[model samples]
Target: MNKIIFFAQTRELVGVDKLELAVDQMAISQLLEQLSLRGNKWSLALKEKTVLCAVNQTLVNYDYIIQEDDEIAFFPPVTGG
Candidate 1:
């Protein structure tokens, strides 16, 4: 199982804080595409907006391949005041 987590505005938009997916290995982009298919809110949050991603607590790009039991997190870019 792959654990997916959402934070900040991304979580508000997606309407979920976390979820578990039964995926073994897949690219981050592919995972995003799959989530976008869930509904309009998912598409708007994941496909339309730009969000930072991390796999196993290390920031990564869309090309990163997710492994089984990996913890994936999505959140908006951090801005300093």
Candidate 2:
């Protein structure tokens, strides 16, 4: 199983900190698309083109490929004060 993690407002919006997906491997973009289908809130929170992502604790782009047991995190782009 793969793990998906949401951070900051992304967690609040999704109402979840983590989720288990029965996927062996997939691109970050593909994962996001799948999660977005959960509903309106999911779509709005995860479908954003600018969402930041990381896999296995390393920052990655949408094309990053993740494997089974990998941990994926999603968060919004950081903004300066």
Q: Model 2 over residues 1-81: C-alpha lDDT tens digits?
A: 888899988889999999988755678888888898888888888875768898888888888788878888999887779
Q: List the residue pairs that clash in candidate 2.
A: none
Model 1: per-residue lDDT, tens digit, 31-72?
Answer: 899999999988888863488898899999998888889999
The Cα local distance difference test for each model comes to: 0.88, 0.85
The TM-score values for the models, in the order shown, are 0.90, 0.88
Of candidate 1, the 10-residue stretch with the lowest lDDT total is: 43-52
Best by TM-score: 1
Which stretches in model 1 have alpha-carbon errors above 4 Å? none
